[model samples]
Structure formats: C-alpha cells, structure tokens
Target: MTSRYTLFLCALILAAFNLRPGITSISPVLQGITRDLGMSSTSASLLTSIPLLCIGFCSLFAGRLAHRYQSEKIITLFIGCIGIATFLRFFTNSPWYLLLTSLLIGAGIGIVSPLISGFIKRYFPTSVAPMIGVYSTSMVVGASISIGMTTPLQHWFHDSWKIGLGFWCVLALIAIPLWYTVIRHPYTAKQETVQTQPASLPLQNKQAWLLTSFVGIVILLFYCFTAWLPAIVEEKGYAASYAGMIGTISMIAQLPATLLLPVLLRVIPGRRFWITFFTLSEIAGLAVLCFTDITPIVASVCLGIGGGGLVSLTLLLPIDKTNSAMEASTWSAMTQAIGYMIGAIGPIVIGLLYDYTGSFVPTLYLLIAVGFVVIVLGWKLTQPESSQLEEQTVYQT
Candidate 1:
C-alpha cells in the first residue's frame, strides 16, 4: 500500500510489542523483588495475576474508549500511562504501591490490546493476518529481550532491581512519539464504519466459541508456562538466571512460527488441520518438559516451540474466523475478554497448586490437561468455513 499506510502499520506493531514484555519482565526478577520487598510467593504471584486480571476486566472498556476518543489518541495516552507506571515501580517499596502500579500498567496495556486488532481491521483490511502475525511476532521479540536482559541489567546496575525494571519505561516512551506521528496523519484517521448485519450471536456460533476456547486454552498454557517455567527449571537444579534465560529463549521461538503462520493460512483452506498440528505439538512439548530430564537448553527449545506456536495461533484465530476487520476486532475483543479471564486463572491456580503440593508435577499435569482441551477446541475451529450464523451482539458505542 502507500508509504503512509506502511508507517502506520509499523506504529501499531510497535505499540503491540510494548504491551507484554513490561509485564513479563517482572516474572524473571520476581525472586529479587520478593527478597527486596520481603514478600511471600503468594504475594509475588499476585503481581502476575493482578495485571492479568486487570487486562481481562479492562478489555471490556477498550472498545468504548476507542469509540469515545480517537483510537490513536487513546493508545498514545495509555502508552504514556504505561511509562508512568513503569517509572513508579522504581520508587515503591510497599507491595500495595506496587500492586497499584500493576493495576495502572495492566489497565493501560489492556486498553491497547483490542484496539490494535480493531485498528488493523480499519487500516489494513486485506493484510490482517500477516499484520497481526507481525504484531504477535514483535510482542515475542520484546518479551524475549526484556526477560533476557533483566538479570544482566540488574547485575550491570550493581544488582539494583529497580534500575533493571525501570529500563523498560524507556521503550514505552519511544512508542509514544511514533504513535503520535502515525495517528496525526489524515490517511490513518479516515473513519470507516462496518455495515451492521443482524444475525445469530457469536456465542451461539459453535465455531466462534471453539475459536475463542482455542485462544483461551493457548493463552492459559502460555501464561502458566511463562509464570512458572523458571521456577520449575530451578526446581530441577538449574540456576535462577539459567531458568530465566530458558524462558527468554522459549519466547524467541515465536518469531519464526508467527511469521510463517500467515503464509500458511493462505495456502491452507481448512484452519483445523493446522490448529490440530500445533495443538498436538504443544502437547508433545509439554510432555517432554515434564517427563524428560534433558538439559535446560534442549527442554527450552521444545517449550519455546510449543509456546510460540500456541500464541501465534491464538492471535491468528480471530482473523481466520471473520470476513472483515470489524468482525475480526469484535471477535478478538469478545474472545480475549472472555478467554483471557479463563487464561488469567492458570498462573494463580498453578501457584496455589505449588503452594499446596510443594511440587511442580501438579502444575505440569494441569498444563497437559489444558493442552488436550486446546486440541479438542482447535479441532473444531479448524473447520474449512465460517458458520452460517451471524453475530447478534450489539456494539455499545
């Protein structure tokens, strides 16, 4: 398309990239934060869960925010808000203050999540899958870099976790100006309304629910793995830093998988086959992770492949199921809003299991169960065509 359109797409992807790493980065350094703050594992777990909970709840308001204000403006403001929240973490010692910052950061990130899909639908109508793939890939890159660097940055700054954690604020700040430039251009602001056609509700559409459930399960698996894998590896006798590095490596695997998925979608008519393949891959990867005492490097490769593929497929489902960008965004919001609520529970449940059993086996077993559920849903979602029913949900704006 035009240079302007290309630039806008880059801006959107950059924004997407910024969304997750900040949150994920904290997990790697949770030990440091826990030691410094004198917190319990349950409290540490809350730090991860609180953001996810907010993301799920706040996503419901994302569409309304986009409707009331220009989406670009809302994105810019919230990203700036993210920067502020990140900066605040460096100064806080109290868990309450940290929790409040988590809420702010999570809400800011949540507002941007659904809007990015909607923005893509509105701006790059024909290129949704590739663009979203690129977006998802960027997110993985950012998460990898953030997690990979946390320990080194902490060491470099004289073991000051605050400085290590605060470094991500700079990335958030960089996104703001790029977002402003993109949103200011008239071409990016041309508003197009979706033609509303009444039909059956998306929830009533088995295919749509299947797609949503697939995304939920994938996210559930992904978040649980990210939240606990480091500790799991540590339990297996690896260093904390090594465990964190493995998590980073696992996140990096998404880059290739996400980039390839869009191309595959074009060649493959039925999404179910691909979904089934990836879901099984996820199951196999988790099985290896649990059953094998392989080296950290080898196990990480398996985990990364499974985690990356699952996340890429989750983002791809909305675009695959919808005919237009509006439908895609709406479906994305609904699925993510509902699906993520379920996914957010994974880490907390895993944490509770760890506390009760004092072993990672229960958590691993739970993940394996989630993987099978995803396969069941992915099999249904892979159907060659959209359902005959139309979505009946009302757009609140």
Candidate 2:
C-alpha cells in the first residue's frame, strides 16, 4: 500500500476503535450506576438499550447523509459527538442524564459504522475482508481495554463510576484528529463522492431482509452477553473483580479471530462451514454458562472466538454483496438499522427475565434458540447460489 493509503487505513482503524467502548464500558460499572442512580435492573438496562435503539434508528439515515455530504466529515463530526457525550458522563447524576449520553454515543456509532464499510468498498475494494478484519479487531481492542479498565479506573478514582464511564472520551478525542486527515486530503474527498448515480437502499430485496435478520440475531446475542456477562458471573458466586475479568477476557479473546477470520474465509472452501462452527461455539459457551458451575474461562474463550468470527463475517457481507461505496453504505444501513433495533431487545429482555424470575436461566435459553436461528439464516445467506440470485435481483431492481 502507498503511504497515503496506509495513513487512511490507520485513521479508519483508529475511528473504529472508538465505536464499542461507549457501550462496553457500562457493563463493568453497571452496579455502581444502579446504586448511585437508584435504578432497577430493567431501567438500568435502558442505558445499554437506548443507544442500541438510537443506533438502529439513526443508521437508517447514515447512507443518505453520507451521500449528501462528505463521508469523512460526517464520520469526524459524529466521533466528536461521541466524545462530548462520553465526557458528559463525568457529571451524570440521574438516570435521564446517563440515558441521554447513551443516545448521543449510539447515534455517533450508528452513523460511523456503515460509512466505514463504504470506505472499504470505495478505497480498498480488493481487500475488503482483511480490512474488515482490521476494523473489527480495532473495535475489539477498544472494548477489551475499556471493559478491562472501567472497574479498576472506578476504584482508582475512589469508587467513582463516573470516571470509569467518562474516561473513554479520550478515545474519541484521539480518533477525531486522525480521521480529519482523511478529509484534509482533497483527492481522497473527491474520489469518495464520485458516483454515476446515488445508490438506493435495497428495501424491496428479500435477501437483504435475510441478511438483516441474521445480523439482528447475532448482535442480540453479542450485546446481551456484553451487557450481562459480568453480572451473570457475579450471580454465579464470583467477586465483582472476577466478574469484570470474565467480560474483559471475552473481549480480549476476540482480537485474534477478528484479525484472522477474514483471512481464513479467503482461504477456506466454504463460508457456511465457518459460520456453523462459530455459531456452535457460541451455543456451547452459553450452554456451559447455563447448565454447569464450571469455571467460565472456557466459556469466555469460546464466546470471544465465536463472536469475533461471526461479527467479522457479518461486517464483510455488506461489502461483498454490493458494488459501490454508496451501495455498500446503503446496504449496511439497511442491515444495521433493522438489525440493531432487534438487537436492542437482548439486554432489556435479559434484564426483565432476571428481574421477574430472579434467575438468568430463561435468558440463556432464549439466546441458545436465537443462536440456532442465526445458523439457519447464515447458512442460507452465504450459499453461493443464493448470493448470485440475490445480486441479480438487487441490480435488476
């Protein structure tokens, strides 16, 4: 790669790094937030869900916004919004305030997510899979660091959860400048905006809906695990520190898969095989958590590997299925918009199930069922015949 291309790649990865910390940081310090704000489990879950909701809703418009404006500018602006929202958490004294910050943070992440896919399609079309691996790996890095550090940061700040939650703003601040350089290069900006015709979202495509549903189920599993794993481990008799470590371990474990899975897909003969393999890994992890009191280390490793692989594939599909930056952006928007809305339910339902039954077993059972559904959808969607037929249908429309 050229030096300029290398710089843009660095910027893209840095920006991706900012996306997950806002959400992941909350889980480790959730108990403190509940104790401080006097909120119950279901209400506290809104902290995670509300942003997911915003992500779903805001994502619907990300493509249109990028089509009308510079993608880099839109990305930089939202990253700044994320920074501002995260910084405000330092002053959070009420549930409403915390929820509002979550909304802004989610909105920022929602808009940035698909545009990054578009960037890959536009700039590195030949390397979409590996670039997505790098992108997704950066997100895992951010999540691992934030989840791993939040509780310790809280302790260091004399038990101030606000500091733990708010400290991640530094990531956004770090990303903005690096991303701004992409816009400052006039040639890159010019190339990004050139399109023979604006790409319309595939609202009428059946395969798009299949992709959306597949994205939804997996994300639902992911967010639920991220939001509740710490508490679930704690309920299983681990100390708070150990519980946080479990979550961090899972996030950290994703790193290798995120970097390697896409490369493996290029070398492997069948996509469905990998999908089934990873989906089964997730189910096994959940089953272990549900049925046995065994140490969670094995489960964490299984989940991290499975989640990392699955998410890398999902992120790749939009680019693989589309022809242009704008098309990829719109396709990504459609999948993530509806997908994240569905995902937003995972955390809330888990919280409600726990509150009502005083147990997490029902929630675990629900995720296992969802995992099976994902396997079927993933198998259908990645089939070569299905992909060819869907591409013809989408282009003809």
Candidate 3:
C-alpha cells in the first residue's frame, strides 16, 4: 500500500464515479427530455441505445489503442472528454446533437471501463478483487446518486431537465483533474508492458458466440428496464420524482448483489446451476414487472438483483474460462463488444414495440423469451473452452 498506489486507487474510484452518472442520469429524467425536445418513444429509446452501441464498438478498439499509447494518458484524456460531453448536454436543443454528445460520452466511458481493469491488474495485482469491489461500488454510488438527484434538480432549477441532466458534468470535472494529476507522475510511466497472446475473434468461436449473446441478452434486459422504467412508472400515475426514487432504490439494490455474486460463483462450483439460477432471477424479475402493478418497489428490487448478478457473473465467465491473461482480455473485449452491440438493440426494440402496439405487454414477453435464451446458453456454458484452436483476433502491437 504505497502512497503512489493509494493515489491510483483514489483516481480510479473517482473515475468510476464519473463513468455512469453522465450516461445513467438521463434515465430518471427522460420524460423531461422527451417533452422538452418533442421526441417520440422510439427516437428517445434510440438516444439511450446509441450510446450503448458506441460503448460496445469502442470497447473492442480500446484494447488496440491501449497497446499503442500510455493507458494512463488515454484514461486521463477520455475522462476529460466525458466532462466536455456531459457539459454539452446543457445546450442541446435538437435530438441529433444530443445523440452526438451521447456518442462522445459513451466513447470516453467505453475506453475507461476496459482500461481501468488492466490498470488495476497492473498496479494492484495482488489486490485486484478488493479494488474491483471498491470501484464497482463506486459505480453503483454514481448511478444511484444520478437517479435520485436528477428529479430534484429538475424541480429546483425552475423545472429544467437540461440543468438537471447536465449537473453530472461536475462529477466528471472533479474526476478529470484528479485522474490527470495522478497519471502525469513518473511512477505510472515506468511500468513494463504486458505481453499479450492472440486469441480468435469472438465470431470464430461457437462457444464464444453463446457467451456473447447470452451476456448481450442480459444486457438488453438490463437497459430496457433502465431506459423506460421511469416512464412506465409515470404512466402508472406516479410522479417522475417518485419514479426516480424507485430507480434509486433499484440501483442501491444492485451494489450488494454485484459485489457478492461473483464471489458466490467462485467459492461454489456448478457454474451451470448457478448460471441457471441467475437467469431465472431475470425471468422472475421481468415476470414481476409484467404482472404486478401493486408493487413497483418490489419489482425494482428484484430487477436490480437480477441485472447486477447477471452482469457480474457474465463478466466473470470470460476470465474463468480463459487460459491466460491475454486470452482473458481477448474474451472480455470481444464479449463486451459483440454482446453489448446486441444488447443495445433492446431499448429501441422495446420502444418500437410499445409504440407499435401501444402497450408494454409485448415488450415484457419478448424480454422473458430472451431470458430463456440465456438459460439455454448457461447450460451450454458447462462445456469447456475451445483451447486447441489457433483462431484469434489480429492485434496491432
């Protein structure tokens, strides 16, 4: 625990705090944005999903970029860009400009997310798990704060969602200087490069496809809820602030499950069985949402447990199944890139389905079907990785 590493820890936590609030804070106040911009449900859903696409697309390239440049410098630059993009939201009058800024925000976050994992492993190899827990919890804090505060800010600032949404820029502004000062130091500059081994593009491996799609399905389900849950609750006669409050509760519920799920999977065997149980949790949570109007809080908590657990567990599988650090990194990059792109389809699909049918019933049923697909994929996950094959992605360095 040297002072240098301690500083790395601070910068990382701060950076994690910025990653999601800029992206997620808009969810609670989406109704405001829609009305302010005169947007349809489908277009609004696109706004949310497009950033996810950028995150997925950029994540694949982030690894290649990190190999060519100093990761700390890359991280510092992206963190600053997130502040700029979030601040840009304050002046957005048209939907296209808003989407453009969302793309910028997503790229900054996408690069930071994968690179932070590598950074943690490099600087705190022996303490990776604990540091991950600390930073993951930091993300949860950021998301919940955004969900809880956005509505209040809207009301406080003369009923303007623009100010409320853009308020998250302050977090990025704070994180940028902290990360910059730490990374500019000499200690981080002299680290040896990590030797990498090539693994096939995820498309080449059938099992990898299963893993990618399964995680993507989980992600799809996760975003569908996040993107529209507040609006749905509002349709049910709750205030936007109340919807935000419930969203906050859902986010708070996510932290403990996200922290603990991977630990449970590691200590206990039967990866298939645990995976099935987690997938069932998603189906069950969606069922609750679809069937019950009497208990939104109950449904939100259930959804949180399912979403957090599935995301954490899926992330763990890439590492557990890979043979080496390079293989693990490859699997993770491909899985996130491909799977997230697939997952990004969820929000827009839900929006379009709702717009077409004028009901959410079809959307919920579709999500439940995706959950069953995850169950099937989880069963196949019991099979071992394809290690003997030489197929792999081309690396730049």
Candidate 4:
C-alpha cells in the first residue's frame, strides 16, 4: 500500500472510532448523571435511547445529503456538531435540555454512520472487507476505552460526573482537524469524487434488503445488550461500577472477533452459516445472562463473546452482500436506522417493565425471547435476496 492510502485508512479508522464513544461513554456514568439531575431510571435510559432513535430516523437522509454535498464535508461538519453538543451538555440542568442535546449528538452520528462505509468503498476499493474489519475493531476499542475510563475520570475530577461525560468531546475535537486535512488534500478529494454517486440505494434490491434486515436484527440485539446489560448486571446484585466494568469487558471482547471475522469471510461461503452461528451465539449469551447468577466476570465474558461477535457480524454484512462500497454504505445506513429504531425500544421497555413489575426478571426473559426472534430474522436475512420492487413502489410518489 502507498503512504497516501495508509494515511487515508488511518483517517477512516479514526472517524469510526469517534462514532460510538459518545454514545457508550454515557452508560458507565448513568448513575451519576441520574443522581446529579434528579431524574428517574426511565429518564436516564432516554439519554441513551434518544441518540439511537435519532440514528435510526436521521439515517434515511444521509444518502441524499451525501449526494447533494461531499461526504467528507458532511462528516467534518457533523463531527464538529458532535463536539459542540458534548460540550453543551455541561450547561444543561433539566432532563429536557439533556434530551435535546442527545438529539443533536445523535443526528451528528446518524449522518456520519452511512458515509464511513461509502468512504471505505471509494478509497480502499480492493480492501473493503479488511478495512471494514479494521473500522469495527477501532470502534470497539473506542467504546471499551470510554466505558473503562469514564468512572475513573469521574473520580479524578472530584466526582464530577459532568467532567467525566464531557471529556469525550476531546475525541470529536481531535477528529475535526484530522478530517479537515483528509477532505482538503487535493489528491484525496480527486479519488473520492471519482465515484461520488456509486449505487447506494441497495434498499431497491431484494437481496440487499434481505441482507440489510439480517444486519438490522443484529444491530437491534447489539443495541439492546449495550444499552441494558449494565443495568441487568446491577439487578443481579452487583454494584453499578461493577456492572459498568462488565459492560466494558463485553465491548472489549469484540476486538478479536472484529479482527478475525473478515479473514473468516475469505474461507466461509454460505453467508447463512456465519450469520446463524453468531445469532445463536448471541441467543446463548442472553440465555446465560437470563438464567445464571454467576460471578459478574464469568457472566460478562460469556455475554461479551456473543455481543462482540454479533455487532461485528452486522457491520460485516454490507461488505459481504454488496458488490460496491456505495451499496454497503446505503445498506449500512438503512439497516442501522431501521434496526436502531427497533433496538431503542429495548432499554425504555425494560425500564418501564421494571417500574411496573418491580423486577428485572420479566425484562430479561423478554430480551431472551427477542434474541430468538433475532436469530430467525437473521437467518432469513442471511439469504441473498433484495427488496428492490418494494422500495421503488414505496418511493414512487
């Protein structure tokens, strides 16, 4: 690989890293945030859910925006928005204000989510699979680091939860200048512009939607686990800090899976086999989580293995099913938007159930059942099919 290509890949990876840390960083600090703001668990869960809801709804517009303007420019502008949103969190005292900020932050991430896959397709055409693997791995590393550090950072800042939550803005700020350099370089601009309108509306293709739905289901499961697992562990008699650490461990386990899955794709045919295997692995993880009161460490590792693999597989699906990066990006956005909308319900529903029933058992059971549904939907999605007619029929005014 040439030096220029290598640097562009690094920039792409850095961009991926910035995407999720903002969302995941809040989980570990939820207790503090709730306490500081005098909000209920339901409201705190909204803090997490609002971004997810925005990610789902805002993603539909990303393709249009990318078409109207350069993706690099859109990415840089929204990333700056994310930094500004994070910084603004410090001044808000009301739950509604925080929720509004969440909407802004979510929109910023929603816009960038689809563009990353498209960028990979444009710049690293020959290396799509591996580059995506690298991207997913970088995202996992960022999420893990954020989950692991937020608590300590809170302690360091004299137990100021605001400081812990606000520190993640630094990542967004750092990414802006790097994104600027990547977008401004004439050579990089030329390479990206060469394929500006690559086929992104894979939703118009039946096979693409099948693959997309499978990817979406996986995302639904991934969001459920990430958003609620810490709280679930806390229900199992662990401290909030320990539960947060377990969430961190679950995210960290994705490193190996993300790094290895792309290579595995080289040898694996029949995408169904890989999809079914990981979907069942996720079901098993949730099953273990539902039935066992084992040590937090042991349970967390089991859940982590499944959770990490599930997310990695979801990200990998776009690359596997599509022939071009534009398709992958479009599918990524559509799936994430649709799936995250579904997944956003998990934490809120779980919180509501706990509120009414005064127990987490029913919620855990509901999640386990949802895992089974994910497996069924995932299997159907793994098939090479598309929904082109459906999309066109719906889109035609």
TM-score of each: 0.90, 0.95, 0.89, 0.90
- lDDT tens digits, residues 153-178, model 2? 99999999999999999998888888
Model 3 segments beyond 4 Å from truth? 186-206, 266-270, 321-329, 384-397
lDDT of 1 by residue, 30-144 (tens): 8888888888776777777778777777777776666666778988989898889988877877788888888888888777887787777777666666777778888888888
Pairs with backbone N, CA or C atoms under 3 Å apart (clashes), candidate 4: 56-337, 204-388, 205-386, 205-387, 206-385, 206-386, 206-387, 206-388, 207-385, 207-386
> In candidate 3, what are the lDDT values of residues 213-288, reduced to their tens digit?
7778878888888888877677677886787777888888888877775365445645666667767776876787
Show how many residue pairs clash in every candidate, following the order shown: 1, 0, 3, 10
Q: Is candidate 1 or candidate 4 better by lDDT?
A: 1
Candidate 4, residues 164-261, lDDT tens digits: the string is 77788888877888888778762344343246454456557666656556655566667767877888888888888888889998887777777876
Quote the positional error of residue 128 for candidate 1 in Å.
1.7
Compared to the true structure, candidate 2 yields what TM-score?
A: 0.95
Query: Model 3 TM-score?
Result: 0.89
Q: Highest TM-score, which number?
A: 2
Residue 298: error of model 1 in Å?
A: 2.5
* Ten-residue stretch with the least lDDT total in model 4: 388-397
Clashing pairs in 2: none
Off by over 4 Å in 1: 188-191, 194-206, 384-397
